[model samples]
Target: MNTLRLAALEALLLTDPLQKVDAVNALHLELPVGAEQSIQDPGGIPGRPSHLEFVLPQKVPRRSVHTLQGRAALVHSLAHIEFNAINLALDIIWRYPNLSDRFYGGWLTVAKEEALHFSLLQAHLSTLGFNYGDFPCHDGLWEMAERTKDNLLARLALVPRTLEARGLDACPVVREKFAQAGDQQAAQILDVILRDEVGHVALGNYWYRRLCREQERCDFDTYQQLAKQHRAPRLRGPFNRPARLEAGFTERELQALEEQA
Candidate 1:
């Protein structure tokens, strides 16, 4: 397919609901078979939109989930988030242009991994007799993506490193909650996501630092200013130091982040 179509596909994937597995599957056919299949086998083609929309809607059920139904609802909520995350990665690749091919490759790899994560989570949700979108979810993650759309630097700094890295920080806590709830399978799934997300955050760091270097700026301080300017969420600590370090965060940078907290 042409580049425009590829980009449109990525956008559609972002808005499409997770319950339509066949529609998801067709997205694969829009690209070269091998490359598209590598993008997690979403089943449909994407169409173009003449305009963009932003709505701060909350759909996930807020009521307590004390029974089996509640557990399933929560699982589906998480699955929906992962589903959006997959498209976010793809959009980064298709929407932005003129970067090094490595940038495109990096995001494509991320998109595939995110798709895998979403599929795994969806399968687990199904076993509990709940599918994605069976419960309501917040639009917070995608909202951040929309906010960062115009500036790749801001996108790299905020979405992956800030918002997505927050996932890395909270994974352990979520795992503990799952264990407490005796959902060993869900806890194990979270473990896999945590391991992979470290790499994702690191990829964001890689690009952010690259941009800083290319532009001849101090990466750490710039990140600080961007966070404040964007009103991005303030980071909390008890950080996963090892994961952050592996994700290309320098010791000095980590110190700076801690100072901000």
Candidate 2:
């Protein structure tokens, strides 16, 4: 039987970006969840395009949003993030088997939404005369995925709750930049992403707490320990309090984030 997890694995291994997006969008959600199966690591986990160049985060030159090329770069950067997001969602679905079936289903939905975000950004990029690979990007998201590969709890705590949560804080500022640059279309695309990402991060919070409960660990404390253990980036502020609240972050979490600021 072509199970849900295996199908997600197939999509994850697709190298061509558009094809991967299409495959994820077309994923069969009705298939059996196959929650108890332990799938082997097939390597080549996240197949990315060959032409895309990855530079260190600092090496990627900053561009102004005022120029057409600069706006294109901005759109391309968001597209790249969405692309990595699709893989991250799929990775969560297939990599950690034996969880509740809802866990896989929730992430599969996220994978499709990530695909939609990518397609939206890609279309906008085309209007700006650029493609995803036309701009240089960093691999920070997938790097965190690699680091959290072995532990499902760590993956939940870090990727969605930690890394993906950062998107919640950043989306408003980035969207405002697009709007200020008169790229309202790009700003609208960001709006869609932000709306969907709130739910994605909420899923992370839900599952992270579920695991912490199963292990009898305090959710906030465990998250703090995992962040330090994984060497996760320190979160800076102007944090999105409303979005974080909607995404299931507790009051204490918000206070800690504020204190971190």
Candidate 3:
């Protein structure tokens, strides 16, 4: 039977935030098993709207949310992250093969949630007189995705665990900023994103451990190796221990993360 997943992945990579979200929402997530093979990487990178100007992380300007323009800038940045996340999840579903059907199923859920997040944030941006691509953004997230493109293990270890996990630590701080700025709705949107992220990170944590177990590798050691090999960004914290714990990180992992700082 033909899987709907590849078709859905293709749809996700098309341009325009609203239409892309609609495509994802239209997916039949359950009752479909992924095809084991028969796909080629896209000839070009995933589609993006023409207005988005990608720059180095250092080059992206930061603004205070005390002003309306500044608040919109912050929301635009969040929308960019969600946009890249949707691509990441879609990429994982199609790029990796020879795993349990559960793997594909799980990533599909991640993709759907990410699409929802992008839609939510994008809509909020509109209320603030901005759109997803109104400001320039850095390509750090997708850069890691490209680095991990050839190895599923590296992808799992770095993209989700190393990169996405940082969101767990960052959300609360951002939420408070939004609230202090008197943007209760913006803060609540962050609440939803943070809640969904815990589960996504948990899925990554689960599969990373699963893959390491099946490969007869030590989980902690393998993660370190992957981080070094991929030159992953150093994790910073003031971590949200409660969220990390909810996201399936053990105390041992938490300790290791702390020691990394």
Candidate 4:
């Protein structure tokens, strides 16, 4: 299926939601790497679903899940995350073709899982009289993606290990909120996300350490250096230690996170 990176670029070039995901689904990473040195960085926002109006994170309102619109709002936010996640995966695949082969294939797996999460959330949103792009969202995630576009290791340190790992710590709290609101289905969906996210975060940890080793840098210290160098967001806690451990964070790393976040 063409060059794998180009297939990712095709996914990133299609603005429609389903079309973009279909392009991702069509990817075959085993194909020979084509003239990757010639990939042109696309302009405007990377292929995104139409009608997704993005606002600053502070501008997006928070709502409780006690009411129908409230529940839909919360779920819409998650769906938006998954959608951007698809773009992030695609962006990394094409933007850094110079990385190890496993890097590209690993991100393909992430893109597929993100598509599943988005599809699941889209279906759930429908039952609540909502669909994706039905509410305003934020660009914090992609902002970081754009910031780290030129640095693959920084992308690994911040996007996946830092931001995505934050999701692991948040899942239980969000699930409990859904459960309390009597939306068992939404709560169950968070469980599904939690399961898959562990692997995704694990991938980040694996790559982060591998890259550090390859560069002869200390893992924990290098993460700190990158976080400082890139202005990665400060972590906060009530950290889900078990989930973090399962996702491959070392105890010292966890302590560093706690100290700084």
Candidate 5:
């Protein structure tokens, strides 16, 4: 039977950006979760479009949002993040088996929402006279995914708790950039992304704590240990404190993050 996790794996392997988005949106969430299924690594895990120019993070040029092409490039960069987010969500669901059914469903839901975010950004980019692949991008998000692929705990800790959490801080800033650039539509899209991303990160925090309990570890200490072992990026501020709190970060975690800044 074609299970939900299996379906997500298929979607992850789709090379075309629009096709992958459509596949995720069309997924049968009502299907079996296949929690115990141990699907083989089919290679080409995250199929990429041929035209995408993957450049080093530092090599990707930053453009002023005030210019038309620059705004489009910024929008393209966001769309790329959403696209990778969809893949990250799908990868977690399929790669980790025997987890709680909620885990798979949670990530699948995230994948669908990420697809929506990508679609919104992609459509907005068109109005700016560009498409998703119109600009160079970095694979930093997926690089972290790769580093944590062998460990589900690390994946949750670094990818969602760490990487995606950074998005919470950046979204409002990016939204304002678009608003100041007179792109009200893009700004509105960011609002939607921010609202949904808070829940997604909360979900990660929930599961991370659950796993910590099962592993007989303190969540905070384990997070610090994992962060150091994984060499996760340092947290910076000004953080979106309210959003972080809404997303399930405790007061102490907020303090720790602030201390890190």
Candidate 6:
């Protein structure tokens, strides 16, 4: 099989509702690139298993319910998100060529952590009598990736710091729900994800700062403008202040973010 182009790999990463196991296994394959005619054909890759089709969500719809099934479904959906996250991190390393070795190393670390998160969530989903693909999921995460593809600085700023940092803020609430439901296993899984995500976002922040330094610009103000220009969601609080601090967000930056909210 021919090695897929960056855009093709990115398309694969965005395919939503993928079975976690299938998606993980597909990482081992040499992805094929389609021709221009094939690309515009909309027929998708032939002879390749359609076990996963990553598509972006137009909007993030709010879901609310108070039932075990509903909770389990939500957990499965999050698991699917994490599965895509793993692929996204790996694809960054593979698809974006010619970066410093450290860049690849950083993304590799993220890939490993995302995989760990996926495994934890998938195991918990199994305990709930549902698997990773058993529930519908939004594709908002991958959408940001697509939007920032041409700008590495924007990709680092929006994806890890903005989008994934939202995960940091929301994780505590999700953990509380799992705890209330007496699903300590799921709660524990979320704990691991939260911890690792902080580091991932920190890596993003580090790179964003590096890029800013290279361009001789103000990181904080530039991030704010990019966030606005890209229509990035405004962050709300109660913030995970301690985690954000540990994740390389300065007090001034946090204050600026809070002011924006």
Best by lDDT: 5
lDDT comparing candidate 4 with the true structure: 0.87
Model 6, range 1-261, lDDT digits (tens) per residue? 343333334434444433433444454223333222122213322112245444445433335535768777778768867876776675565455556657656766676678678777777777778776555566677678778766888888898888888888889999998888777888888888898999998999988999899999999889988888788987888788889999999999889878867
lDDT of 3 by residue, 1-261 (tens): 556567666765688777777776766656465666667776566667877898888888888989998899889889999998988887887777777878888888888999989988988999888788889999899899989999999999999998899999999999999999999999999999999999999999999999999999999899989999999998877889998998888899899889877
Query: Residue pairs in steric clash, candidate 6?
Result: 14-54, 15-53, 15-54, 16-53, 16-54
On lDDT, who's better, 2 or 6? 2
Instruction: Give per-residue CA lDDT, model 1, range 1-261, as digits (tens).
Output: 344336435555544445333333444333432232223335532221213232344534554444688778767767766776776776676556567656766776676677778888889888988766565566677778777777889999999988888888788977787788889998999998988899899899989998999999899889988888788977888777888888888899788778878
lDDT of 5 by residue, 124-231 (tens): 999878888889999999999999999999999999999999999999999999999988999999999999999999999999999999999999999999999989
lDDT of 5 at 128: 78
Residue by residue across 76-186, what tens digits does model 2's lDDT show?
999999999999999988888788778888999999999999999999899888888998999999999999999999999999998899999999999999999998898
Candidate 4, residues 72-189, lDDT tens digits: the string is 9999999989898888888888888676677888988999989888888988999989888899999889989988898889999999999999999999999999999999999999
- Cα displacement (Å) at residue 153, model 5: 0.6
Candidate 6 matches the true fold with a TM-score of 0.79
The lDDT, on a scale of 0 to 1, for candidate 5 is 0.93
- Please provide the root mean square deviation of candidate 2 (C-alpha atoms, Å): 0.9
Flag regions of model 6 displaced more than 4 Å: 1-66
Sliding window of 10 residues with minimal summed lDDT for model 2: 28-37
> Can you give the TM-score per candidate against the true fold?
0.79, 0.98, 0.96, 0.95, 0.98, 0.79
Model 3: residue 5 alpha-carbon error in angstroms: 3.0
Residue range with the least summed lDDT across 10 consecutive positions in model 1: 45-54
Whole-model lDDT per candidate = 0.71, 0.92, 0.86, 0.87, 0.93, 0.70
